[model samples]
Target chain A: METNVTNIIIEKVKKSRISEVDFSNLPFGKVHSDHMLVCDYRDGAWQTPRITPYQGITLDPSAKIFHYGQSVFEGMKAYKDENGKVWLFRPDENQKRLNISSKRISIPELPREIFMDGLKTLVQIEKDWVPTTPGSSLYIRPFVFASGTGLHASPADQYKFFIVCAPSGPYFAGKVRVLIEEKYSRAANGGVGYAKAGGNYAGQFYPTQLAIQKGYQQVIWTDDNTHEYIEEAGAMNIFVRINDTLLTSPVSDRILDGVTRKSVIDIARAEGITVEIRKVRVEELVSASKNGSLKEMFGAGTAAVISPISGFGYRGSDYDLPEMKDSYASLLKKKITDIQYNKADDPFGWRFEVI
Target chain B: METNVTNIIIEKVKKSRISEVDFSNLPFGKVHSDHMLVCDYRDGAWQTPRITPYQGITLDPSAKIFHYGQSVFEGMKAYKDENGKVWLFRPDENQKRLNISSKRISIPELPREIFMDGLKTLVQIEKDWVPTTPGSSLYIRPFVFASGTGLHASPADQYKFFIVCAPSGPYFAGKVRVLIEEKYSRAANGGVGYAKAGGNYAGQFYPTQLAIQKGYQQVIWTDDNTHEYIEEAGAMNIFVRINDTLLTSPVSDRILDGVTRKSVIDIARAEGITVEIRKVRVEELVSASKNGSLKEMFGAGTAAVISPISGFGYRGSDYDLPEMKDSYASLLKKKITDIQYNKADDPFGWRFEVI
Candidate 1:
């Protein structure tokens, strides 16, 4: 990787406690590595960043994120194969998405090079945290927040950008059963649902808990204006297969544009699955299921990779989906995992390796 | 109000020097107070509270707030009225709302006693920072966050509850023009829009910025499913005057139950002015504006007691409201301020003196 971008100023590093942290059975998001990256903007100029010790930073109580919720974050993972090589799947897409989320939440832009450098150093320092366990990885969180100090219901004047890593295992290795929510929506046309902002998830907690209390594991949110169209399930983008045709909702301002969702779409397209990215209404899907046209449904995200939807509880009716012996979700998930674990050919150049 | 409420745990305070702070009329949020209150929850109990020099708390990069945005907060003001009487305007409402916000966001409930005792202690310690100038007050922020140590797209087990205060003044005291957005919605049915969650505000930053670019100062968000109903201004509850009757949208699951809005309703009723709490549609409002039935429209909130809307741009048309010679908003704002500053009779028993 290049040492610097032409216009950006990289900060100096202040090596923190070099004490080693074991990756063996590391719990997700509990242990952070040394040398976190930070950049400050004042007088409209992003100052030189510094890699400092992982310590608590002071913030005013009225900081915008604490009040207005002007915060957005991204979840990514870094993998170290048996050959001691580090691989980042679709890092560029993440940086771009972070920018989009920043703009949506009124946060300043983070330079792409800074994002990369920070990730590389953090992984190198906490390299042992990447577990060798199957279905386990190092979860990386890159977030930007409004650290401005005021009680006004407005955009913040200052911010804090950070990246932290956590060792994580499989979220849900087995199948997922979801409930279609015909009332609540995760986001609206003019809402922050699509962005990785903290508010969207906060909004879904109560309803999701209600769904969980009612025996369903997750709630699949529908369109805000009309609960007719299926948007997303929990925090992941969903895909349905109807007689070998892959269908998923088109990414709108209201729905998150997931990195895994895009990757799955590309892989499915390469496999000639005839993927359709458009509105897939609940009525149409429910009718197709009754008519025996709907084959299978699954969710895609960085955590789960891919999770087969075994069944869906619509209102009061539960529609049982057949477990395909040759499911597309399993196939795509395996292919993506293979590529991620460096077990498959990197034909599309999707994986970027850090030496 | 009660002496037995002191389940207070005295904690050590740490100081950090931010010598590089440029505080020359620095913009809001650019500077912070010396210390911040932090309390962590795990194992069904809150840990010993601590007040540390404001600094960043190390967190797993994959914390749920970063990815899912599961966070919520509250806004309340601490006033140093004349004679140095530190008063809180309806703190119980803020504490109750904070609990409700935490419940909806899936963050653990901060005990009522902790909220009250914490605020009193924090403000007392920082009492010298309380600005005494006219219109200046210490903005107290009591917030709870989902700072769990995992990233499974689920609710967090651990949380951090804090109360930070900022010395500030009115946000939007003067009148400004606003637009009625019939097409874009802020919250949806069965969503966390009513709560002062972070995600709700994050989504509005983009659309509100767009409105600002169009020369409008604020956006009055309507119902998502149908834009026919007028809901609220971007950060305040809206009140529309049709003749002598004041009408506002009822607090539904989709609308924030603003404390100021409720107070205004109570004052109007006390004055024998008929008040109605129901859905105010955009068409009806526009029609009323056309026939001179719309006498005035104003927004109510803690930050801005009553922000009169001089004009509203709706759809493809603009309507300038005629200024009221003796407006209800002006009268209510004056009465509320008088009570808050201990200048007039607090008929509603709203203010609570703290030492």
Candidate 2:
């Protein structure tokens, strides 16, 4: 059956697996929806998009993605309001960033129309998969990879774009303790850090594992050169609240321009709070923590709207943050989640209704 | 059938495709041989290895490799000597480095016995695929990637190790020009630059493409911090020759410990040429070029034994090196290739006989 949206071909699954999923207890990225959106790029153009059953893909062993890591992905979520309507939070930003990432890795930029049409159509078809539980939503993963079958170390001639949705709960359960990285780095000056490239995440796993071994949940990466400036936490943009003012590192070629990060800054400023986006120094954060000025720390991303960080370790020492009833993290998270779930008016026009 | 080496199960193809290949006109990595080696890591250990017909692999859409870039690879060559004997040049080095790369990325390491046995058995099975052309041989690509079916940003619970061979010619044909990069970087200070990680190569495609647009074949990467010190070239270790002395950067966390790079240094030093293994500054190179002290420059790697650089572009200025009668690149390449193909005495014991 053909849908009214952008001529996307639809092939529904014979049976839906919705009954097998336990909506009350959802793990992140484990339970995928019944249907997926797939599009192919060949002969210098993106071919027709299709919505098919979520299944395995076959590719030659010499496919470029397996060898060269020519892959890029975007993370998004669909929240079901109490009215059974679904809303997406600034999905246009993810679409734009996906193309930006593709261009950086030498993959052809995906047209915005294809991304949006395919995504919305797939979500509308699998609306039942969206969880209605508080703080649980359908985590959408839109990714593109080189499917060209060759080992030549250049750009590929064939590609595949896919959008898979998984019903997932919050990314972080409780407040996390992070370690300030002093040795390892996540990105370089003119690297793919700004883009949602696959390599950027792989490089962080080892360092994060080391931090986990040291009893921390994640590592707050530093600048590759000096390891002096606070960059971002694992898979999320970091924010520090000193007394009443908020501080975050300005987005650079070495840092991701997170949608959640921007929303937090905008929402905080709108609430009459000071939001300073600049190069955050490690020494400043440590001194602020000691002087009782560091009020709160949190990580912002698609999966976790605002993951409050309890404390941080740096240079063989641990620093704990004081608890507060009126924390900025809680305030910002409440605001963002309200907008995402369509419970509050989106003054920034960030929510997109799918139903 | 089962092979005697490590209990590897062997499955031959019903029909060999050797007759269809025009090996004399082979591209770098487009054509493959008849069989490949496969080993899986699951249930806390590596399972029995297998040799099967070269074919595509089936994987779930949410495989970690497609999302997080948990992949590593090694490049090698299998040469058939005049006496119809197959030989691998330093197979143990490739096996050891593969594990080092896996450990850094938190992937399970393949046992040394499995790697060696699988590689030799596969090569022996497809010995006819090893080209006999003067400058051509079978290009072996041994790679591992995360195959577990999940999209979580962590090390995969399952992995697949494969060895695929492509009968191909050299990577670079003629002398080429390179751009001395000042803005872009290939790796960070404490990153996976030393590993043959897939991300390292993917990060280079854009900068290399930009250099290609500027009429350069490759980009001579610099340190991420200052962009002052010379790192490696696109996928090969770089060497600069000043007068009769050879200079190359020492392997660090941000530079690959290339096998061919080490071989070149050892061969040059044994030939009574002064070799300096230290940091090569960009300004020092430009000064040497200006003073007419620079004799030659070349890149060393498994694919391209020695790729001579004709000239270099740095900061909008192009500098050409003087042509020489007795170039060091030609001398070292000949010495190394001779040892690899068993044309000369095995003084270094670099060759491993497969048959």
Candidate 3:
């Protein structure tokens, strides 16, 4: 059983595409690594995962993912240190969250061994793709979707889970301006908001496009019921710093329990900073901005790590946040990246070495 | 430009699979016709539409639809009359609704001519696949999804729109029992519920599975805010007959504007029945059930045409609806089927003949 679980068929690409890729000008999720990990779930059990060359796949027109949106995904990064050592930061959290999302979307749970082993094997094979440049890493996307060909609106009997890697620099630019959303909602209270489901992201595209037309880079989504409390900013969890207190929305079924957001909280507590997880109302944020107590605002996610909010637009007015020399965003970002790149002591044991 | 707009390259299947299918036991959305109509959108314009054999499509693993659910679809039917003529009921409404859904999900809108001509041509080519059975018809599904490779949480630069047909019998067997949902929600106010988006159906699978486990076939969804007012019943618009008046929830951004639902409303009003489109509260339903005012309940959709509700389960108690000799469900079902089959006069110009 152990051999069966660990036996992964390795199929390398004929010619590497690394030489053609410009590492300095890497676009987000555009250039893929040479190889990927693919696994099929059939007959109520997961088959042994295989390493294959990155390529297109054929699916029937009636595949459930195309019609029903029964899919979930996770995003993480692999960093290469000065000694050419590849490391993954807090991958166990991603595995746990993926299973949670799968359960909520009626997909079968994947064992942790498959996820870890697959990640390790694939990263080791494509270690050259992990850029060593500052503020750059190999972005890893692991997704599962219903591959069965049927139009019935039920849980599919067959599924495909795969992991693909891409060389990426940064998701956002230096700073971002966000619009406060009061009309369109991303997720409801008792919906798939907590899960990393594909449907949650698709619903936001139009609303985000509307915000972009209004000169905002992202939209800070509020609670669907009352549209009062802040939930998430774009695809990431938001944090607001006011009067030395780090405040973020509590993790509920309506808010995604972001790994970066949780790590920031833990790191802040360890560094003797007050962290409060509670309902952060829109009115409170507006008042704080008016009274000059809104010290900083940033978004936390695996893609951006830390996306600082330069200003926010509410109603018809724009409120600009003053720059700080020792902002919490910078402090937390440096601390996290230091641990990720093997430049600092690993206190919480979050690093996993690949090769 | 004229040639580009009207050109449709035809590619018929080498051998027809219709002989192998059992027309009596047709499954919903399983046995597809031999030909399909496909169109592509690229370079800021919709290319020429084409007719091709129903086969698998190759797509990159990073296709936007797989990760973000950037897809929309419409459902209608092709019925054969006794005189061997095929007719589509209210196809213009489906074309308009498909564009509406496309706009909400950030996909490019499909032209009405393309939609109409595509359906007409595909159904004309595979007209023999339309089952002549009383309860069977050729189910038409027109869907548009993002087919671009890269994934960046934005609308794709390319899209593929296609229409497929399947010979299907009734979607549900006999009358179905539904559970009143109070915990989970299908869509919220100011969301994508009004659109026939793929994400909307994907979210309902788990909740409907839970209801199935509890001896119910469907779930009666409620308002996301308070779960007080009834919204949609399963994938169809619901109607409750209370004391000679037909009551249903009014169309809103959170409620789907069902075509069959509209037809039923029109047929009911034409037959001198008082149709009230207002908020149907849960408490009012419970009271109606207890006081014997709830006469009949049914669901309206293209797949099922009209699904009679035998009874409903609320909280921990079951409410059984008494049988009626001339129930509104039967009358409306028969009237709609007659119009669909061309047995009755085409009073509303809802039927479009194909060859």
Question: In lDDT terms, how accurate is model 3?
Answer: 0.90
10 residues in a row with least lDDT, candidate 1 chain A: A4-13
For residues A202-240, could you state the per-residue lDDT of candidate 3 as single tens digits? 789999999999999999999888888898999999999
TM-score of predicted structure 2, chain A: 0.98
**Fnat for every candidate:** 0.66, 0.76, 0.68
What global local distance difference test value does model 2 have? 0.92
TM-score of 1: 0.89
Alpha carbon lDDT at B102, candidate 1: 77
Clashing pairs in 3: none
True contacts kept of 1: 0.66
Residue-wise lDDT of candidate 3 within B158-254, one digit each (tens)? 9999999999987888999999999999996678999999888878988999999999999999998899889999999999999899988999989
TM-score of chain B of each: 0.92, 0.98, 0.98
The list of candidate 2 runs beyond 4 A from truth reads A1-5, B1-5
lDDT by residue (tens digit), candidate 1, B51-125: 555556555544565566667777777777778888888888988988787777778888777777777777777
Per-residue CA lDDT of model 2 for A1-355, tens digit only, reads: 1234477889999999999999999999999999999999999999999999999999999999989999999999999999999988898999999999999898899988899989888899989999998999999999999999887888889999999999998888999999999899899898888989999988899999999999999999999888889999899999999999999999999899999999999999999999999999999999999999999999999888999999999999999999889899999999999999999999999999888
1 versus 2: better TM-score goes to: 2
Q: What DockQ do the predictions score, one after another?
A: 0.49, 0.82, 0.77
- For model 3, the stretches where C-alpha displacement exceeds 4 angstroms are A1-5, B1-5
lDDT (Cα, 0-100) at B273 in candidate 2 = 96
Model 2 agreement with the true structure over B1-355: per-residue lDDT tens digits? 1245588999999999999999779999999999999999999899999999999899999999999999999999999889989899988889999999988888899988899888988999989999998889899999999998776788889999999999998888999999999998999888889999998888899999999999999999999888889999889999999988999999999899899999898889889999999999999889999999999999999998999999999999999998888899999999999999999997788888888
Model 3 chain A — which ten-residue stretch has the worst lDDT?
A1-10
Worst lDDT run of 10 residues, candidate 2 chain B, spans: B1-10
Docking class of 2: high
